[model samples]
Target: MFFAVFLHVLAFAFLVVGRTLAPRNVPLLRRAVGDNSTSSGIASLALDKSSGSYYTVLKAGDSYFRVALDTGSSDLWLISSACTSSQCSKVPKYPLAYKSSTFQAVNNNQTEFSASYGDGTGVSGFVAREMVTVANITLKDQAVGVIDSSNVTLDSDVSGLLGLGFPRLSSMSESVTNSSPFFSQLAQQGKLEYPLFGLSLNRFDNGSLTLGAVDASVVRDVNQISWHPVVEFSPFGMESQESSYLQWVTPLAGFGTNGTTLSPNPSYPEITNNASLALLDVGLNGIYGPYSDVSRLFEAMDGARLVDSEGGLWAVPCDTKQNMTFTFGEQTIVLQPSDYFLGRTSGSPNLCISWPAAQSPSADGVDWHIGTPFLRTVYSVYSYGINNVEAPVIGFYPVTNSTTAQADEENLSSILTTVKFTPPNSLLATPTDTILPYTFNASVAAPTTGLVSTGLATSTYSPIFQAWTTVRSAIPTIAPSYAVFTDSSGAVVTSTPSIAAVTLGSPPGWTGPNGAGRSSPAPIVVTVAILFAALGQWIFCFIV
Candidate 1:
């Protein structure tokens, strides 16, 4: 009888395991082949270590790590170590109540969540209540989501993240039972003015997030600036109900010599509507979207080229002219030469810089992205309070003399150069054993149909694991040359090596620094512009 019982148990285990292991393919893998079909959430934030320009932030618990905010996603999450659930254990985790006297968890039940990465990395974790604070606002007994894992590799130094965009791309909608995000809570309390908040991301070197009130010092006169109403939406479309996203008109008055790029021809050649709220963004990186008119404006004036990322193709160029200007509503502001910034890429061109462009998709007429690529041009402000209503609107102003723009790039270069990369221990050809112990009596098998299951399951896995061996085994890329500012006369002053100059397999036609000289006899010419608040309905940014 004992022998028979043992044999039966073995057969049951095989039956369960066979069902799950025998599925020919995974649905997540199939969906991943598409261009925009991805689960890795893109987000943005301000880098505190060096430049103040807002980038992206990633989150795990009570902690919020800065990352690149993205409009391409609909969910929000942070990597954490505290989350022991199989889902979250792969990424870094932060202890919810570690150091906060104000920390209190309204709910502490361990829940599982799964999210995909840009390189096809995915992790699952447990969710619970966490005490969190943003700026000076402390959230007590806040229902927080937690992921407890450290198996996934990170692209940069973001500890966690805060997602401040739209609701349609929210993780709360998927896993949490009864919880509202921080921004929504602020709106409920009527803590903001104009029922909105504004964002002002200065050039990458000198940017800062202006929440609630205007800095006043940066602008000529705050009272002279005209305010407008924010747009509203339901789900993915415009709705009858008032929206929480701040919408305002761009006042073009104070911009310097170059004048408003949108054109003053009364026809708004570049912009079909100046009343559009494309610039309203609080936690985003900078102005992003497909604006053909704006693209032509920059192409004609600054000589920028269009580029692409997960967000979409934006403008990128080798060099820029100084003293650029933009006007909003009744207010006009001018940006000096230094406000423009540059970027580097791992793919094609080793060095990628920001440029202005206008593009629209077939489904959406006017799609604008306020990302870091655009934010680095000016100082930004956000007022969570407006019209006795507490929504958020983004406001912009020029940034000067601050090291905000240069800092993020310099720091990013430093982090990448300094950190050492390590490969995972095991490389499996097919699906390997589960990292976490299986609790069910039978192995969970993959379904014959529908790659769609809401709950976190063993079947949900990242495809990046296949490439781990290839990437880890290869040698790191190195830059070949350095960039040195130069004058028309070709004299050198100061020089810095280019990251691309050292790395291999980087973008082609890599030019070290311009050979003219180490320094430009001309002063570092710059311009500064501002962008405002982003919507609370979507994922805002990502950590690099």
Candidate 2:
């Protein structure tokens, strides 16, 4: 009995490695990576393809601006051939009439930076600290905003707006002493390996921007990362003086239009039915609320309709083949009626403008805003930790194969609006290639921006600013952040492997996006006695 067949094959190989060991929740980024340390940064991907919007190239000293990467606003500003704002040749200016030696003027006389946007668009620049490179990370001085003047509709591929929110919402000259975005000056000069930053986008534009690491190839399921918790509306937001963590805000948990549940007008205590509180805005490409919760989410989408079109904009209906879910902290995320439909108006192909409406609503306590059509379907994380016991965190990892704008809803081309920023497409990833860590005194390559397909959006009506559109519908479709599932050495498994990770209440439909999930792990039966390991190992191999 060959020792009872090797004790039943070593007890079924330790119960199949303890039942295929699926236990995780690892996101303190592995005890903050030390004993060696590792983090990375190397952005690539730019697509305006007619206003589906998505940008980031940034060079600064030798010309290469495109910028537009907003995590919900902060401040970076470009457009400055000393701004003669004829809307400045459609945008991307800053050559400062030939690199005035990479402009350094931070303040021989500061106080003009007055910028503004949520789409109302405004810019009045003058705040330079320069040097700025990206890819190999180089800040030198940083604080840039030279604009001089503007009307901000943005095109020419896109030439301004980098602001990754918080530095006290830095408005450059909001009275000085404030200003440090661009990853908080790359984590106050230490240059991130731990401060965090990683956005992936796809279906709206190409993707990949990983400063300080997170792009282990755009995570297929870093175990199910969907963390969310960067809240701060402190005494009504912009927390002046002793705490303004400034916006990246979150708290949406509801808003489902094809599977039911669109309720939230309980007389509007700021939309309290499962508690509202949105504003995930990747620098607004639309999706705003409070016109009575976007008019009951377009009347729950059945041949949807909503027109009024003046400045408060709303014209939804170029043919809505409906699909939009969005509920967080139990996770929901789904968007694909061509991701929010923002086109066909100028000559009206029967109309089609549904970004959700807001660039014109007053009583600014904020009602809703989750833009970039739900950030091209997820994989967005933002961190700023290094203190406060490692605070600041926000994640959502669903996008698995998102080649970015996945053929824009079936081979669609572009040409819808402006704010264009063109000039970088070899398929993208240039700074002289090699995702950079440094080495490009001048091979020049950062211009990439050719995908512009969002044509027809020239509106102007102000009888107290109004707007809308509508038609066609459908619903109930999610639970597929694109799926790929890997682990037994195939490498790629993301958030959702937990022994502890479920931070507090989450799990009604998705234990994903990034917090991974809190608990439920109660299954480990392993009862391998096998006749006490084959008669006590054959009486210890015949009593020794």
Candidate 3:
């Protein structure tokens, strides 16, 4: 008890006085990134120690920025010489003002940009054109956001951010009138050998980001790519009542050992959508679902209970033997207990937390987002239609049957090197931060679930404060958008949320120090017989 108290107090001290300074400058990287020898490119991957977010080194014009790749939102933005906010001061910023040759500034009111996230991080800036090098492609005059102000505190950990979402969702979507994003432009220009790419990651060791080609080495059987079409998202929310639409969506055919389909049956529908839809998001870290559906799902496992972490996360007994299997299209995935029991609380018999987060960041309520923990077990190819078979499709292939794989599955780089799209560039791959166990968010909290442009369409703010204010006032009332179900006879039906939707109130805007992949359990103050007992637990938290 004394140990927990002492660390909690120390953590609080760290939060107040411990500020990690970001590297203020790196040379305007005049050199190109990756070898310009091949049609495809490969980037090494790493996870952030503090935030548990993933990022890779990317060269933007004259400088190399460690940028996080986000699939939930669009816009390649970085702190810049123009930013004057406190958040801006801590992140690595490019001297756009001094690097005139590399930074081509665009200053029209229309060119100025802004974005807000569910966690309340917002960046307001102007759009500019600059050369960007990723993998093997040296993209010229790519649109980038030079943040002039921000509410996000990046702790200088990452230098910038890269958006991997659909172009229409880009922060500059209005400026280009919804044109193609940087990667899409590569596809349009035929610079890449293929229209799509694949990312193979491991909990430990290293992973690869294969652009323009799916890394065949990661999958046991490349022929087993189970392709499923993506369902369109319903922005208005009402359209879901008649039909369902969600980003990267697909029908969840059935569940259970007997393969019970989605139905009016209360047991399953309570925690799951009546409609049976699940979205595949690489940006989020765990599978999420509405409160009721997830509650029901856990009920099946003895000792599985919901614990309200900062973002409504769930925890299950570590000894749980429940085998949760999911069906995607024509394929089935059986999850080992390790797949869901992601973290543990300290003690002789540590408490294991489940990997599934039980809430959605959006006002739209909860639905499932298949993220990092789930993807690690399989090989996923997020495909864009260059072959013309379909515009956007998700292909899944099982790659592991391990009961518990705490480390990387295996380095298939050697196998990938043999069949690489083009003789790969000999660019350097740097090692990243150490991956830590779940530590009661003795760290931070985070996620990027969807596009943040709904409220950005019209906003004129003065510096950082007003910019975040405008963003908060703009979040549209969102509720559970759509649902899907599979009938016993194998027929699939999609439906809308039955609850009357209410637009949520304006947000607090840019929750301070937004942590994208970590959890922040709400503070719990427990009392013991002695005052020392309280102090011990508080400080003990920091010990982790």
Candidate 4:
């Protein structure tokens, strides 16, 4: 009896110590399956071959909705059943709020949200609070926009967009005081073990969006990631009293081909000595840069020529072997010919459309929009800082090494048909003609290049021009959008926008900014306490 009583006293003492030692923000225990395996925190993503977009499932209330994961914007919007836009007919729509048991209207459904994108698409809807779930993390009373009208054209597979950008970019910021985005809510509620998330995007297989943790399956080494500070400045060309953190913008230290670094266009002298800023946008299918810079890049490749200046399309010889390189900080990422080359042009089998297209300078003064072509080759991690104590950073882990890229390029070359046609030097000049007309049949089989093929017969313009128009038109623009708000009474509402991680040079450990350790000891202490209590109960029974 005395021994049993002693055990109970010890158990009680342990429980008290455990409670006192527990962290104020206790992290969820890591799954036992693997350190980085898909737990409730990882959402699998499907790539749309046609549009080059990646989407994942978002659980809002009781319904499962397929939404694109867009880092370029900061609004969670879904097409409502009441939407009558022609574009809405092409995609899925969310059921009415009445259908959801957990749905609560924000401001009695008087708050309205509207946004316009760079792709000439826009959405206007009412804001509401709903229980939203992504992967395993659940955000109760999360702000969601139910679109009553929209012109956004999305892949048939996806119904909406889940913006993973900063809250300052949110369209509903003025309407809802608690307008934090889905990911932001996770941080605010201490759902993340770490304040960062990692993306592992695959070209052939389904990728994953890992929340609060890095995906270890794709990352060979933690040391592979080179971290860079996120650009914190006023939106390029916008006048503001103070600088603000906007998109996931980072510096592009250098760009080159075949070990030869290319100089920035002399016209944009700002980027001459300084590194050009690039927005790491997953929503964009291809890489876009200033016209002069893009022109210079293609000009370096053999038999390459500008096809459509307005659409920013270029034709390169199918047999070209030029390798592209991009530098971020001290790390350099290389893309072999197969990685950046699109499929062959229809009728003009000797030439192919390059994945790096041209675009005017972005409103944010960003020089480059690095999209799937660049992202697919690396594992990306975006750190929002731990409890707002650290500065934000973007880390890139090279998934494709030099040897792997070489093998893939060789395989691609083996499957491609050889061509002997030489492109005219005159075609390299940017065309000032009206946008050329081109059409693509949706039912054609994708070439071995894993890209859509053109079905051009013949046209007045060059065969390259005809093929490029269709290909360029198929690629959508996914830059950050402008926000506009309205009231439930259909009156326009105007408001001023209020402006709102990780350790560098450290190996692949749990250390974050300021050497804040990510490892948690609370679980260990709690487990010990539970075991002691269980043992004490057993001892008491044995004594009895």
Candidate 5:
């Protein structure tokens, strides 16, 4: 009997080790395993006071500029001048100022290169780099890819995106050999106190990005557990093996009621499997993972189909309306119907939802991406590691309504209004204007004046033509604006005040400045040009 028991024990040990061991690449079955635990003891420090800036550097012409920083995608690229295509000129262009400075363009004479997004959006540019300065810290000699396009979604405060991730794969990370990733560099230099970063995405400002430390005031317990290096090559191989990280797990008492009580896991009484991991991301705007399992863990009101964009996984439309609840440790969060939809379909009366479904798979198992929807719902913290693995705690704060859905019913708007502008035309000069063709840049701001909600206007009125300027000036609201007007008087009024504010649909009485035509060129200016000296330096680095 004793011998038999020893053999059984040995067999069990082998099973655990075999299950834990995995290949360099992630597996499909492993990622499908149901692991609903939340990683715990991770606290992220808050740095709401700092300004997040996205800077750009051109390679083809050795130019540099600053744009907005977006955490929605994983690519460090720029727009260059060599791209003489009409579309390239329309987007923001980099100035040729590096000719006087010591910069390098390692790539060839090819004026354009292609950078593809998970979405259908792709830009062409040349890859180059130079010493970049951020928060007083200057990195000498870095690699940057410069593309050409004017349709980029950059604002005045937002110049370009600086993706903060592990090294080896990142353009900024691999380019600078001595310098580590942006966040890693800060931690190594002892610039951060807790080795963590925090983010509070608001409707105002450029959404907050805090580096170097976690906000202690926002977290429950600080020294709850010992930190470990982040695990690469997990069950699905979603992470890169470039470095070490940790995932904090906790055993919950149980699933509770009213979002407060914890129940017992009858199958495993003493062992709770609620584990949560720290995700250090800057390119993605939202918290990601399975809606029913990892990340949010909340169920939608209705079942939706899964749609896969070229860039990432998205939710599909479903015929039935549904509702469900998710229990995250002590926190219980609920999602609304509109939160599930990405946009409204023109053919159908319903909206197109945006959520990740379990059906899709990328080259590497089932990939996960945190999009803008998720970002708007959480207050995430990313901690920079100090002394390599010894870092502060990281935290994930769910954006709860604070008050229940019943509390703020009055503030929510059932109808949305947008604005638009039109050129000075006959409608304003002469009355009885009938159906006149109109068009505007929906990618920019909505129209603000001379908007029409219904039929053609008979009265002469001029619509505001500065929708682009007004929308660009909006501080933090992502909801693009629009313009509406009544067609009482109809001559083309390029500039008139007879407009009403509209929430949905096209701006009223407004026409594209270029009129009703598809082939309109965007207006992008290449502020100032100095010289192309950086391109020459970059060539020398590759030759030697």
Candidate 6:
């Protein structure tokens, strides 16, 4: 009896140690793919073309909600059942207090939470702690915002947003309770094997979001991934006093069209090598950059001209074949014409709006906002670094080849041929309206503030503005203009018009029609140890 009890105790010890030491591998799932249909236990990402967003499933309490994946901001918020706002009514909401047994309001729901985005959308609510699960890994008592009010423009398909940015960017961190973001919570709880996550966003098919470690299957060549150190300062500029990095800002080595590089704006001389700073944001659908640089970028393309000087909207010939290149470190990622073209305007089927929109430095001090147009070209990995032991880095691996780009270009050309539009002989001259350069005032000790444009049509006489308004009227399902800004006071402001719907072609530099193939995850060491321990108990029983 004594020997048998001793053997049982020994087996239990081995099981406990094995389970604790084993790595946790969680898979992100595409919304189109069923929740139970993860491929080899790897997360799959899905793109919603209507909203121009990518999202994944997140489970809170007993219910699951689809949340948009945003790396630009740092906060995980969901509309609550208590919310009666029209925007909140459109999407799925978190369960009521009694509905979920695990839901607990922090500070008796007195602590307020608020955050905003570059696109002029914002959310405000109370803080709560609940068991949140992504892929299969669960973070117990994760702090999340129970949004009671919001001006965020969300489609019916997505419940809310899951921000994968740093802790300093989190509004919850600045709240009374001072809670960390969801990803940071996972690390603090020792749930991740590695302190990073990988994202694979595809235009044609399903993509993936791998937590803890890189997904070997999606990467064509791991060794080729060019990793860059994350910029330490706030991408929004020196206005804020946050002492840590906010967004996934990285160094942009070069940018040009058809091998001709554009000169960087001389106003910001702090950047090295005339290179601009780029924020890799998955939430934003298109690219935004300094007004001067963007103006030069469009000038290089045939029949391209600034359509709206104040709004920074540009138009180009639908049939233009210009190729743009963005260099980062030693890696140069190229984008074919099909990738940058948004689509033909409703009023003018021949004219197309360029995706690389221009923004004044006063609006957003960041030199560049690299969105899906650039991200879809390669596989991206974001490393948070292990508790300050390592520095945060953003790595990119090329998945698309020249052959794939050629095929995509041909496909776009075929579509454009059906629409009749005349090409301009020379580049149209820009408007005479002057846009002033951004200047930092060191005398005033205040947080950074700037006008966040809605990037939608306003009351303007420009033909492009009329065309944009016509398109918005044609699409009745599109949300109305709503501007929510996050400044020093955290005020929610209203704006007019949102982006008009555009026809989506194959994204610029996709690997193939179906994207990369999947591979089985490697065996865990803990599983092997457990099996060995169980076998030993059986052998000892037989010997006795």
RMSD of 2: 26.9
What range of 10 consecutive residues in model 1 has the weakest lDDT sum? 17-26
C-alpha TM-scores of all predictions: 0.47, 0.27, 0.62, 0.68, 0.46, 0.68
Cα error, candidate 4, residue 311 (Å): 2.2
For candidate 4, write residues 67-111 as lDDT tens digits.
777788777888776787777655546666235678888878879
Candidate 3: where is the Cα deviation over 4 Å? 1-38, 108-110, 177-179, 234-246, 254-275, 309-311, 346-350, 360-366, 386-389, 402-544
Q: In the order shown, what is each candidate's alpha-carbon RMSD?
A: 22.8, 26.9, 21.1, 24.7, 25.1, 22.8
lDDT of 3 by residue, 1-544 (tens): 0001011121111211112221111111121223543266666555543333456666676555666666666578877756778866665565653443666666552477887654435678788777787764677778888778887656534656777766545648557553346775665565654455676765532345667665544654555666665544433322222212224556566443223323212222322334355666555555665445555566566765555433344455454556666676667776655555444433313235555545422322224556666666676666443321223556676766643323221221111111101111232222121222321221111111222322211121111112112122211111112346665678665532232111111112212232121111122221122223322111010112
lDDT of 6 by residue, 1-544 (tens): 0001001121111101000011112233322122432111245555554334567666787655667787887788887767778876666566563346788778899899876644345678899898888866677778898888876656533567788888767778777353778876665444554456777875532467776556665564455666776765423344454334556877777777867866566334443234466888887666777777788787788777766555466777666667887877777888766666665544465577666767654322357778776788788988664332344678788766642235243455443322222234355455432334433332332221111121111212122112112221211011112234543566444432122221111112323432121212232112222333432110000110
Collision count of model 6:
9
Q: List the residue pairs that clash in candidate 4.
A: 40-136, 236-364
Candidate 1 residue runs with Cα over 4 Å from true position? 1-76, 82-92, 96-126, 149-157, 166-178, 190-211, 216-221, 224-228, 234-287, 302-324, 332-338, 341-354, 357-359, 362-366, 385-393, 400-544
Which tens-of-lDDT digit does each residue in 334-389 have in candidate 5?
Answer: 44333333333333323243343221212211123333334444555543322321
* Residue 167 in candidate 6, Cα distance off native in Å: 0.6
Backbone clash tally (model 5)? 125
Task: Name the better of 2 and 3 by TM-score.
Answer: 3
Q: How close to the true structure is residue 18 of candidate 6, measured as C-alpha lDDT?
A: 8
Model 1, span 1-544: residue lDDT tens: 0001001111111101000011010000001112432111111123322212233322222233433333333333455445455433322235443433543343344556565542234546655555454433444544454555533433223333344444434566446654445544444343322122334443222222222234333454453333322333212333222222312223222222344345432222122233233433333333433443344445554534444322223333323344445455544444332333333344433233433323332121123434443444444443332222122233455444332223343333432211111212233122111123221121222111112212111222221112122121111111112245665667653322211111111112323221111110122222111122221011112122
Q: What local lDDT score does residue 284 receive in model 5, on the 0 to 100 scale?
A: 29
Model 4 misplaced stretches (Cα beyond 4 Å): 1-40, 235-240, 265-273, 386-388, 403-425, 431-544
Error of 6 at 369 (Å): 0.7
Encode model 2's per-residue lDDT on 126-226: one tens digit a residue: 78777776654667677787787876555433557677776766766355553576677666454455555777765423456667556665564454665
